[model samples]
Target chain A: MFKKILFICLLPLVASAQETIYDSFVLAPGWTKLSFIPPESGTYTLPTYPKATNGNVINHKSEVKSLYQLYDNKITLLNFMYTTCTDINGCPLATAVFHKIQQKVSKDPVLSKKIRLLSLSFDPKNDTPDVLKLYATGTDKQLVDWQFLTSSSPELLDPILRGYQQRIVKEYDENGNYIGSISHILRVFLIDQEKNVRNIYSVSFLHPDLLINDIKTLLDPKTKNGTVIARSAN
Target chain B: MKKLISTLYGMLMSAFLAVALVPTQAFSDETCMSPYMAKIVGQEDYVYVWTLGQVGVGDEQDKLVTIAVNPNSPHYGNVIGHVSVGGRNEAHHSGFTDDRHYLWAATLDTSKIFIFDVHTNPNKPKLHKVITNFVKASGGIVGPHTTYALPGRMMISGLSNNQDFGGRTALVEYTNDGTYVATYHMPHDENLYGATKTGQIADGYGYDVRALPRRNVMITSSFTGWNNYMMNLGKLMGDSDAMKRFGNTVVVWDLHSRKPKKVFDVPGAPLEIRCAWGSQNNYCFTTTALTSQIWLIYEKDGEWQTESVGTIGDPAKIPLPVDISITADDKHLWVNTWNDGMTRVFDISDPHNAKEVYTKVIGDQVNMLSQSWDGKRVYFTSSLLANWDKADGPEKMPQFFKAYDYKDGELQFKFAIDFATEKLGMPHQMRFGAYSLYAKSPKDGAKVAELSK
Candidate 1:
């Protein structure tokens, strides 16, 4: 069953890779080489914008949980995505970057235990708890804690989307029949241990190396309000 | 030779058909809007004109005038609606938030920033919030000029300070919900603020702000203060002491940290800054008001540099370039010269050398220019300042909003609305609006989603 679900998930990606026209749209820098060097980790500061709001969610293990409980005392990188988003530069790009970050974090003993990754789905009707569980199959054994979550209904999901300022519009056909596709501006967020949103990343600024550096910056002891719980290897 | 000629003819016909058959995207807005804001990729439904209330015009209050521009609508080429703020406050510039849900219009004289909800009803924007304590909240930084959008906040540039009302000012940051975040002062000769001054002068003046996120660089251009801007144009020009007080520096800063990195000496009051949109394009163009020259701020050899690329009209004539708009392709730049009321187009394919290709007189005094994304539609407004505007005469209307269809390198006049005759105030800055930004169809009563709070 796991193999079958994985095959179904990887099918669209394979087809998209074969059919993509290189010049059709500009690939964001997160998918390619970064154009410039980022600033040193602790030399700069990320001022808090707003506190990350909480919502009721069902983790991949079919257990009910509060978003704040998952974010408790952990440096979190949260992204909103649907399982079937086919836009190469949209959800797939974010998931790919998160995957790369997970791989890099796994190599670092300290960072692997200090950070948490959350992928929450706004399409509750489509991505149920079981769907998220299947999607999060291989993440269980990873050193870093990666959780895939979804709500029971649109009512339960709306507040989380509103809190994050993540806007998504559902597509429909000429007859007003629902299409599975959703349109949104991709965003990834970085939350500190205290649940304050430190940074927001759009397509132009979403890179794994940049995310890792920001994570290290938040954990650096020299930073204001930052504890020296873990040190990152550069 | 005959076979080759036939083949060339066939290729030419195919190319012409390809060009003729493809539909024009028409997806652009005042091409220099904040990149973080949502864009109207289709036809814009309305143009919101931030008007400076003249003493005897209409209600004698600064108003947000909505002009229906989409040709498909019944009210096309007409003033559909308007909402007047209480009184005249010297309204100058306005911008939208990152989500494009609210329009923040700032007044230079009173330092009042008015926020209007453009998403709830794109056709008729209602006053949402007003920040009346800008001077007190920003710690004496006065005259908010540019309201630029960051990720989740608005970064505003100031023209003068409340202490001395001089050109020295700072940039203030505010959350989208109207809470003040912080204030960053510009680097001056007295306080370098850890920024490297690469030239002889650091005037610490502020007018416009733009950013290149990939390079982590945010740039600000300088203009004069309230003392000179609010003065009578004729008298101020004659006063040598006031004339010498214009800003002469442009500062580059680290975008993430909000810290100044380097300051370049770009004399003669650089008012508007338009950065190129191309992924690889790293340069921005700013035209000087006093010098009548185009200055390019670009990165070269891992260092940000400034160069005077070309001249606008004639320097001796003092064309006074006030507003500039670059095309989405970054190939052409439209520069509006206020003194001569002429708009010149420069071919800037080569960033180092910009050459003028076309020029046209827009009005008696044109101060703002906005072009569409496809370079097909151009919009112009003619009001620099409430006191600086040219008086209305029988022949020429100094305050007006004009639209033209740009095709084949010529501006075919589509329509014009004379503000004085229509009883509307002097129109200064124009921003585009569309219903689609909020997931609503253009049709009336279309199902609209609740925008994020």
Candidate 2:
């Protein structure tokens, strides 16, 4: 019986293993953007971005403004990053992707008029309004519309982070000594004109083209009761 | 005329050779392949076995034991290589990058993540780097349980938090190259699932995460932290306060945003999660370790819902359904009962009406279950929690890996490799490696490298 079982086990080895075709940007190089259709049944849709609870944000010009009011009936792509982030794939990647998106949208009249990007610095102390203004004013003229916002202090940013459910913790050593920096997940929220979060892009999926496709989907007109209802041109 | 005929004959011979060299389909279609996905497919050269030394006896730390898996190889069924990462940090689930180059393994206690460069050599895997400051980096989240790949990064779910160290936990993300990215906390305060009137499941220790990227949705199951799991089994059962420690909820997140969209109450510690194979099947299954039941998460008409699909063993005895593995066709599910030492196979062709098909005992204690790409072979490992693993059972034997042959709805035990006998420790997650390590000679089916005399 043991011999028979061993023989049977060896049978699978004689057979070929499963083929795994991974989804990658390289594999599907021609996929500039995705064309999605609302499913008829058993579908999943992202929840609308909740209204920004903590409205206290200081813009680059040092003016107090509500974070939610910045949406201003526009498609907002909001992300949190510090100016000093050195990780190539962390804050730097997000900033680069935002710049690419800005450059792409500037060419498309529909996207340029409808979408707005927000980069909020969670390190409020170091990234003051003046620092944010300096950080936003890069040589790239294409990023003119992108706004850099920050709070007055870590305390003021707490409610905003909590509302967004962004888990940010200060690093410490095994000896319990402070590491002087914060650890956080990179989440870029894509909010619609109605203040609903349509999607959140992480490091891997945070491509300019993918963001543009999602933006177009949200901008596309909806059919209600067999009538073509045009979305608000915000 | 003779020269023309010779040229035509040579072209025909070359065409025949090319056609014969192509690999034919001889394996069953199995899709979900992450940590276990080998770049070269069926010819898995090495098996990277996560082993824990005799921690209960204070003799060993957790390590990675590489065994030649190619049956025809000379080193087959032998421990040819090992990596001893000192400290018994309760090494659990591991995953591989999408490119199948690096293997990310984590320890629960210290949250120390070890990335092994499996591509360098299938047999001798080198420790590329280590993420040492997970606790400080992930803000108070401790105990990294599951390591899963998402594009170019690895998404890890924690089983405990530093503040309470009971159940409150968070899910963290990091670049595959060991850079800290961000964190998403599971729902603990409000009713995420809206199950009961209060809508609060209390504990939020995250155990497993599975996502449907196309649907832009991901689901996470909950398990208790190390402290709760390592507590005296009898004391934990008797203590009413301790009974409330295990997580009883599953949260669904927007995959793109990493935000919790829905939280459903799955009572009694849901451990392993296996999503169905295809994009059309917008459903996944998770086993409740404490309750001995299998729960199903499905989306209907754009709304998400969860339900108790089926029960695994006698709930009264708490058989402890610890690990779950699904077939490539999404027709069957293999669930391992840690306490009872039995692997139960369920026919999941119909999500709602699942039936138990087969059952077999592999050892005194069984925890993790990994299936081959073809779904024809199922691998079983014995060891759940060091202290909780059959501590008081009749037979306190060594932990081993039992390979079974699944044919026609039955699981027949084929062979067993004893890890405990060699004191190599307890094997947890078993992943496949590249075919180059175990390539066999075509003539006599001999492995290229000869084993040491």
Candidate 3:
């Protein structure tokens, strides 16, 4: 018991003596120099990429004098999409994920106050401000803080797309018939009051429970975490 | 009577015009920041950094860094700055576009984007008037990751929002203005629920989608995160391409043709590769992550000619390799480990028959790794916050960033940041953007002397 206690005390010291900087490759807890990660599943604190270097915002949505003004002090959830996107998997899942987030958050009033949702249009011409407002509210204003946004034309939104690293391009088939489609990836960003990306998730992969739990973690001030994922609001 | 009526009409028209134009002009004039281009020094210089896990959101969302070393300037060493963007909560990857003035940051959260003006004040950079964030269909948002810039001011983000079917993926596109032009969905993979209780999630997800030079070809790899994260591991809301290797599928698409050109049966869940745009513009040469092997394939005489240049994962236990990068010289390909802190460099001069040249052990396991263009020094970040979260003071953080000498396998320097010291929000995502071919190595991780209170 004494020896075990001593080992426990020194464990952190030993761990602190050495460190790993890159996850792309590393030594396992019980390994010597280098080893390959096995083809198995495990929980992890996934690493994130860097922010946009150029400091440019894509002007895909309608040119609002100040898009940020659209949601003043509200914890807004902004989504990305184009008008010609037919991929249900990309756009539909994103909307569905929000539906899931809404279902879970509606019950928790405290959590809901700081949270608002908005969808930013990838296509400006078709996705005008009117179209976005109509699309987000569903003509009923079902969602209180939800808003959809778009820019004037492609030029205004170009830098914004590059800044986000969200790929956007014209589509043409073999015969050159404009597919009239815009292809993009799908994920929802959960922003905090300070406007930091607290949590990000692929729409389809986003489990409503997971999102709810994450919001709980962010809303609560007690969670001291280097990589906090979620909490049970219930 | 006619004169009096005409004069009255003119007066009314003038009054109406005054009311209409003032408000709009006032609002527009208040803030009209524009995204400007950062003057490029060296040839084809680009920056590399760790993007926050967001499609694009706040301070940490659209943030990007590059190592700028211009001998003629006051701020010549590593330049740290960022631009704000509107999009998802997490950005996927960041790179340079259009004469190095525009920075491209892809998000893992939403498809929102921005083109920041890094050319502004280097120290405290501000974005000029940029693009507007895109609004997805009435329903949901999509995920966008890693990008490749083109000459015609084009960009591509490999995608996977697999919901109904097997990791159905798409190729999202945008105009140079940061607007959503259109989307190119991958051949419908409609199989998110290969095996699940909630058929809403797909078992597969396409990952590491990247663009290669030589016109139209783009590549993507995928894995089945459903069974691993959802079923066995219970990662309800996460990337499904975390576990397993068999799901490795590399899809190469034609940009101009916009057709599913061909799908290569990758060995494992391919991660990243160093496809240096050599003298040849027809094909891309890169390394696959999940498989721990080097794959070289190029379009020669129409058909795809392929070959495995090198091997990484030990055949005995199948140790998988993670990230790979090519030196600025385009002479060697560097491969880093995922489970172990080991790195191997291979000579890819001859794309078909590459060989491991350098090997070294650095730490327990690194989360991210970066090297100078010349490949003499390496910079990386710790996988966990333990290093920084537990510093000497009450609210202290260990050095989140570290530097090492690759040639001698020496621990040259380490940086320990203190929330109490710098008084800045704990510094995370330490990255080097653009430096000259052989930029002077940064002063090793020696502790910066604390300022006198």
Candidate 4:
């Protein structure tokens, strides 16, 4: 019996065991940076920057229910975020950026005429529409023009984020505590009036003037733009 | 014309060799071929390597998955022709009968034993039977964590749960065909243990069931001793009162003598204890599922001397530390830790500082671990206890194996042990060598070097 077993087991051994392939890379920091890994360890990879899903809207918050009765046929600025996020890079930064975008867009008459701001929360738990409405509008100004939406679960949040090609995963300690590592897909989507995601702006490129130019090109097709999203003017 | 014919023949021969060797070498070299890998298996030469079929975790179809490899392929190791053992859940253990005939496994999801035949293979191997129901009537307890096969007679087993809490590590017996014979409830002092709310009382399914030179002793270490001093939870120590109630004691049951021995207790909880013939008498070495530290326990100077030697994490791709086996040579100690992502090897020649010489990541999450007679290549299976997706679930696809080059710390190969068409369920425990093919010359393994030089 043993001899028969050994004979049967040895059949696959004449394989030429050579050739090397290395699939190694550094674990980049943060999730939206598209470098989030599994609950376990190993290198993190962000899927191809997801093309944004536009024109879809639902009311997830209360007071902000009718915040903006009319959304001008303007280009929408898209940002993904989540609540229960304590890290500066997670939900806080996305909201803060949208807050800044709201201020900047409100001032630019020509830009505001054709563009809006959208901030979706990856964390559906804490960030109800009311909470998001409270969050988007700082103490001074209620950035009611910007919409903050939360999905039902990680399952729902996953596709929206992955659609926008964003990455996120729960962070844990040596003892397995669920420390939040909520993050966004760092790039802001510049969707045109057609609800088509047109331009990609890395997080660092989110300056107001630069964004103004990009919107100008998307809206008018011909104009003098800036460093973030500039047009040829021709 | 003659020259042309010879050339054509040579070309045909080379083409035949290329097609046959590519995939064979490809997977092996990628997963288990580094020179450093051989050292991990701790064997001079590998006799056999067979990848298994797909087996799901209990209810969880995803997560836990594995490929079983019998590197030392028994002297008579390939009898079943195409049947072997493997699974989807990681961090489980196994029970094999002597002579490598019957193999039994405890799954992570259902906490039941799955059985298989080792002789069922020529190249492709798989499991023939699964005894999903391992429950016996014993004081309202069910769910077993580990199993031990005593050849064709009856096998021993341990229980893991109750309605409110898990029950004692009750020892049970099973017939050769994977039938539950009877359960041997362990001796526990409820007064000392308290009522179990989730095995929260004073005990749990036994951890390690080992046979020593003198007799059989199954060691039980409450679950609380396994995780970060039970750090993740709000409380310290372990999950329930049963584990804490036991006070981190090593519960030993001598099956032969029918005697129970609470030999030693660590300041920390000890989950699993294995007894091997050390240079001294049967020296029992144990790892604290609680501390990640290994302890050397032996009776000396009229008392048990427990010495701290080394440290290791959970099994590769698994969530908790589990079944461990010391090589026949005892020079190498192999441990399967929880969610650790790799199988660790310790050179115990110097037990004082048992250096981690090498490691090999097993498939998905590792449940139980097994070894070829030579101990060069180690085999691991999956279990659902460590959050392994239960068997028959959608997520339980693409399960494979973890082969290490014993010499180099690298994966020798990872083959899809999953055979899609057969619909093989979760793999559990395994034993190698149902048939052994003799060498043509029958030369001594040591003669190659002497004769050549």
Distance from true position, residue A69, model 4, in Å?
99
- State the weakest 10-residue window (summed lDDT) of model 4 chain B: B29-38
Give the TM-score ranking, best first: 1, 2, 3, 4
List the candidates ranked by lDDT, beginning with the highest. Answer: 1, 2, 3, 4
Candidate 2 residue lDDT tens string, A18-120: 1121121111111123322222211222333334444688888899888768888888898988766543335655776776688678887756878788999
lDDT of 2 by residue, B1-453 (tens): 435533543454344333333432223322344422223335455678887656553258888888766677777667787898777877877887654667889887778998898755666788899899999988989889788877546789999888877878889987656767777778766533322222445455689998776566788999887678768777778889888788898888777546577778789888888887543677889988788888899988877788999998899998888888877567888888887888898999999877898888877788887766666667778877666655543125658887776777677776778875666778888887753322222233444332100
3 or 4: which has the higher TM-score? Answer: 3
lDDT at position B446, candidate 1: 33
- Which prediction has more favorable TM-score, 1 or 3? 1
lDDT of 4 by residue, B186-225 (tens): 5555432211221222344354554442222334444422
lDDT, residue B174, model 2? 79
Candidate 3's error at B260, in angstroms?
2.1
Candidate 4 CAPRI classification by DockQ? incorrect
Residue pairs with backbone atoms closer than 3 Å in model 1 (clashes) = B27-B41
Clashing residue pair totals per candidate (backbone < 3 A): 1, 12, 150, 140
Best by TM-score: 1
Task: Assess every candidate by TM-score.
Answer: 0.90, 0.64, 0.46, 0.43
Task: Give the candidate number with the greatest DockQ.
Answer: 1
Candidate 3: Cα lDDT at A228: 27
Candidate 1 lDDT tens digits, A69-126: 9997999999999988876567877877887798789999887898999999988888
**Candidate 1, after superposition: displacement of residue B76 in Å?**
0.6
Model 1, chain B only, scores a TM-score of: 0.91
